[model samples]
Target: MAAPAAKQQGFYDCRDAWARTIEELAENDPRIVAVVNDSVGSSKLGGFQKKFPDRLVNVGIAEQNMVGVGAGLANGGRIPFVSAASCFLTGRALEQVKADIAYAGFNVKLVGQSSGVAYGELGPTHHSIEDFAWLRPLSNIKVVVPADSWETAEAVKWAAAYEGPVYIRLSRMPVPDLVVENRKFQPGKAETVRKGDDVTIIACGTMVHLAVQAAVELEAEGISARVLNMATISPLDEAAISAAASETGAIVTVEEANIHGGLGGAVAEHTSANLPVPIERMGFPGFVPTGSVEWLFDHFGLTATGIARSARKAIGRKRG
Candidate 1:
């Protein structure tokens, strides 16, 4: 393992981008509407509420009803973005999400705000580590986890335009913007942030920048680690995974959610079936202890240094 890179200078909460992008889209599209479970402030939709008071629907702490209402709104030919905390939105209203939105094949954009451990000290009940697992099996729902502010905005814009069920996972955790040349938001396609041959680190959401930093640290030690931003968990880019597995021969999957049925599990399932490779999945094992967001990240080895360590282990497991 190599030393972590210098501390990031500035960090951005992707929720801001989500809010701004949706508001901009709403300005031109009259059908655009927002449905929340009293999370206008938390979802960073205060400005949006002020701009389109009538367009903002507050269901008052009813996650199930909120999702049902979003489905109804969609049936009425309105593009309703159902926003709420990831935990309650997915856990509380999973049936609605499965039947009303996904199974029904409604044109509703489900914006899961404060996803993963963004709720931090609020404990496991509030932590949304199982959201990916809950939604991934719902084949009709396209699950997207944006890596940064730019990606966040792009995913929102794309979801609004695409007519179908989509889940845009956003985090309150701050992260630096990735420095990818000619960056474009092509959902379900892995964006190569750094090219390497020794090992590949596939990550999404807040873990993407950390994975890039890990690749830099690995580079210092003559370890070429490829970093891929796998923003879309569902409808995964199988081609990228196959290339990384066959070319690199080793892989380390990192995500803010649980390893099972999340990004890591998705990758492992694909590779194990198509192309076998040594893989190390980095994420919460199960329910985590109470702590701040930063502490939890470090404790769970979700940091750049930890990711680099995992990458080395994966490389060591590679067989000739």
Candidate 2:
């Protein structure tokens, strides 16, 4: 079945929400400090710096040192939000993140900005597709990928109040707010955007809206496709995944990151152990070729049509 055309809506850059929410939190609490790798402009924390100059620390292109400084700040009772380009923040400073924050159990918020392919033509060297795979194994750190501006703000708020290590992945891509009634941000829980009986399309980060559109397309073709906004990747909503596998019988996992050791892998690991079901994983295979962000998404089948196609394939694989 062909995927239905997407309806246009107001788009938002989630980094703006992250910056605004953190500034608001800082206004109330003196302990809220932002540490960056000279990424005040990219992380959209310029306003934060202007409002609280003394609190915003720029580590000057040193990703590892920035993370270490964040850990030190946490040790001193300051809630430090380490912000940097996701590529460098996760790849260049992975050991610091695993050791200083995860293993040490610091009260730090690692904010990975411009995550995924938001870097566009900068190529795979700048793309952050490997971040989830790198950070997911660090059991102590909570991994979060917010779908839109609302979730981004909510995740920031939640991470601030929770005294533990957290990695909130944010993107500069413009996305429309999800249409969810009485929305509440519950970390490690899947938000059922659309209910169904045949198949479930689970997605995170920027791919969630595309999954919702795919579900709409499937509904028109008499295939009920449930859509889940899996904002939190690590410590996955296993209960929701189990119910989807038991009731829907088929699952399609999508993300803007690699299919390996990401949201798809998390869901697959759970379902494979508990409720065996037909599953289709969608995302980049590995190092993607250089292209515009739009091209990368379409080329890698991360769009509505692509997700709908995978949904059908998973449905076809279901045991009768």
Candidate 3:
């Protein structure tokens, strides 16, 4: 993946992809509707509202009620997207999500907009470092954190068509296109952006771009680092993970979420028991730090420089 000599003129925010998917899906399938907690604007749905005013259901600031309404809508034959900030959507209405959505298997799409540290200056209370940890344990639900605009758009299409509960964390951070244009997003499968035998860099969400950059850096240093964008967190791509471990011998897992019970924990559990290769997990150490999202990411060591350094350390350890 070569960095553009000049930053490309066409970088799509993942939110654009979300709104695009909603508009396209709604055009064909009238069942596709959006339900939010008075966050239609912040969640980037003004266009959606203009297109489908009646279909846009705003349940005010009450998170729990917002989700319950979504579940009811699903039961009534409408495909509802329960969209909200990740901190509020997953944290505030966890019970509603568990009982009304997951347990009931409602075809409600939970779009977590502005997730992770995208809340930036709002502090830890607004950060969503624990979403993966909270959602991964739930049964009968799919958790996805797409790596880039292509993955994000495809994931949205997949969730809209699939007849089950799903949670998608849409980051506020801008992303370049990954995978070919409109690539097929396979649920429960990891996409190997780069293949190598030295080490495997397993990452998802915003950290995936950093992982790919790290692999490029490693390549320049004569290290063969494979890059796996593990988009599906729950019902994780364990098979791809095991293959990376058995084939590559060393692995580095990265995420914008907490290192515990997110991408790292899932891969560690699989690799430690089955493949048992050396692993270095690069992510938040449980506490959600206070600062701008960029500052917190740098502070927590998830920038491209940080991931590269961690990959170097992991490769060294594996050689020993």
Tens digit per residue, CA lDDT, model 3, 1-320:
11112334655568888888788999999998999988987788999999899999998999999999999999999999889988999999999999999999999999998887777777778888899989988968999999887788889999999999999999878777765433568998998888899999999988888888888888898988999988999898889988998898889999888888888999999888888988999888876655776678888888888888888888788755
In order, the Cα lDDT scores of the candidates are 0.93, 0.92, 0.86
Candidates 2 and 3 compared: the better one by lDDT is 2
Question: What does candidate 1's lDDT look like per residue over 1-320, in tens digits?
Answer: 01222345688888989988998999999999999998998888999999999999999999999999999999999999999999999999999999999999999999998889887888899999999999999999999999999999999999999989999999888889999999999987999999999999999999999999999899999999999999999999999999999999999999999998999999999999999999999999899998888889999999999999999999999887
Please give, for residues 204-236, the per-residue lDDT of candidate 2 as tens digits: 999998999998888899999999999999888
Q: Write down the RMSD of candidate 1 (Cα, Å).
A: 3.7
Model 1, residue pairs in steric clash: none
Error of 2 at 288 (Å): 0.3
C-alpha positional error of residue 27 in candidate 3 after TM-score superposition, expressed in Å: 1.3
| TM-score of every candidate | 0.97, 0.97, 0.94
Give me the runs in candidate 3 sitting further than 4 Å from their true place: 1-10, 179-182
Question: What would the C-alpha RMSD of candidate 2 be, to one decimal place?
Answer: 3.8
TM-score of 3: 0.94
Q: Please give the lDDT score at residue 83 for candidate 3.
A: 91
Candidate 2 stretches greater than 4 Å from native = 1-9
Ranking by lDDT: 1, 2, 3
